[model samples]
Target: MPFGKVPVLEIDGKVLNQSTAITRYLSKKAGLAGSDDWESLLIDIAVDNIHDLRQEIASYFYDPNEVTREAKYAPLINETIPFYMDKFEKTVEENNGYFVNGKLSWADLFFVAILSYLNSSVKIDLLEGRPKLRALKEQVLAVPQIKAWVAKRPTDIP
Candidate 1:
């Protein structure tokens, strides 16, 4: 708990903080990180953008006052969501349904992870206007492991 965070991973007796770093480490170990450096770079970019979107949603979650939350939600729904969703839609379209290189990578998994949180927190369908994003979600969900996990995952939101 170097940062007092829950996602700290203990791998080989080495503690790793930061969810993204832990994910990259484990994904690489599982051969789901990326095939090569360039693919990894692409995945990095996509993951960063996805995190940016998540941050916007997190702002809404952490606001203590209704006035502040409502104020934040407007710009989030109007500007931030649209901007990132459009970019992600384009990236998914260019990457052949996957988030990168037409293959399943950590980037796709990251999006799927955040997608659920975003879905439960918001009233609107975040991917309503983004067909490619919808397809990307479907593609990620189709993975047998992910499908099984989600079927039993808790319905809690944060």
Candidate 2:
């Protein structure tokens, strides 16, 4: 009943119940998706991946089944993290050592979030030997605005 109904894009009369679609549209309109198609795709991938992983993590936290808990997080602790480390390293190296589009992009932000997850949740050195990954994390955090935001993010967003 807020807004007296669903929020509508009155300019063209588009209606969406979901927040993701609306944000994507606003992103395009605001020039934040970037100047080119690859850049926009990179942004989409990063945003979608964030949604995917965070959902899994939420389930990991709330799953009442022990088997489900182990299954949900074991791959996170053992496999997926290492996979991301290797994959992101190679992607950075092959893409001239930039996260996306030969420059820092939302993909890097995803990397940072993943790193933060690992740092906050895992005791193991999941990022060990991944200097490039380390550098990438540092690079993203070195941005003053992002640094402040990271500081503001909760330790347990699970």
Candidate 3:
């Protein structure tokens, strides 16, 4: 409620706001943040990049005017998405299917978690043709904890 946001987390009578801050805090507690400062920095970089791309997609997805939306979609689908996705693909390949430290980090989880929302907004599989990214997604979702959650998560959203 600090920023009137729905994602605020109440912990031990204290409130935490902002999705990134909350995710980072939880990642640290969950052992998914990173192994060290350098690794954490790398994870932060990847997460920030993904967030930037998500904002771009949301801009196009939320536009009210059809004409402007179509105009925005052209460059977004043809250029922006490919540009960011290609970079992500190469990064995942270099890291051996993870976003940072060549192992599971919050960045990987964050990317995989938001991917469905992103795809839904665009109506296309962003991972299509990006084998490394697709594989990363599979790897994250295959985690026992995440898989179990996915099985029970709400399916009402398209």
Candidate 4:
């Protein structure tokens, strides 16, 4: 596999690595990218920002040293999470419960998809008090295709 990764996707005998690249390609084909170039740009911005936040969470959660891990937790919970979540909540609220263009895009699906992993890493409900974010989660999960997929997808991972 290219990059020796599990997420590599092979289509028409061509291999694609990296989750973001694969997701973007599928999103475009699935009509979830955006309505136009500008909207797609906005979706890309949101997805990139989400990726940055995920990197921060992963850095703290994956550190093997207990003391350093403990040290990172406080700032992550107190500052990092709220800083990002608040902006995300506001964006969702402004966009009428979607990440961009007031409609469902790959960005919304991306955030909702990784939320459980984020919560598991942090050991807390990241959307606990954020109503808009909670609504956004509900909105995405309520999609018939996503709902069916969630019901049938393997639950082996936490």
Provide the global lDDT of candidate 1 against the true structure: 0.85
Q: Cα lDDT for residue 143, model 2?
A: 79
TM-score of each: 0.88, 0.62, 0.96, 0.97
The residue-by-residue lDDT of candidate 1 on 18-41, one tens digit each, is 878889988999898778888889
Regions of candidate 3 where Cα sits further than 4 Å from its true position: none
Instruction: Name every residue pair that clashes in candidate 3.
Output: none
Local distance difference test values of all predictions, in order: 0.85, 0.65, 0.93, 0.94
Worst 10 residues of 3 by lDDT: 149-158
Error of 1 at 139 (Å): 1.2
Evaluated against the true structure, the overall lDDT of model 3 is 0.93
| lDDT (tens digit, per residue) of candidate 4 on 1-158 | 87787799999999889989899999999999988999999999999999999999999999999999999999999999999999999999999988898999999999999999999999989998899999999999999999999899889854
Worst 10 residues of 1 by lDDT: 149-158
- Model 4: ten consecutive residues of lowest lDDT: 149-158
Off by over 4 Å in 4: none
Clashes of each: 0, 0, 0, 0
Residue 45 alpha-carbon offset, candidate 2, angstroms = 2.5
For model 4, what is the error of residue 157's alpha carbon versus the real structure, in angstroms, after optimal superposition? 3.4
In candidate 2, list every pair of residues with a backbone clash.
Answer: none
Tens digit of per-residue lDDT, candidate 2, span 30-128 = 555657887888777766755665565566666889898877787776766666557767767766656666676656655575665655554566458
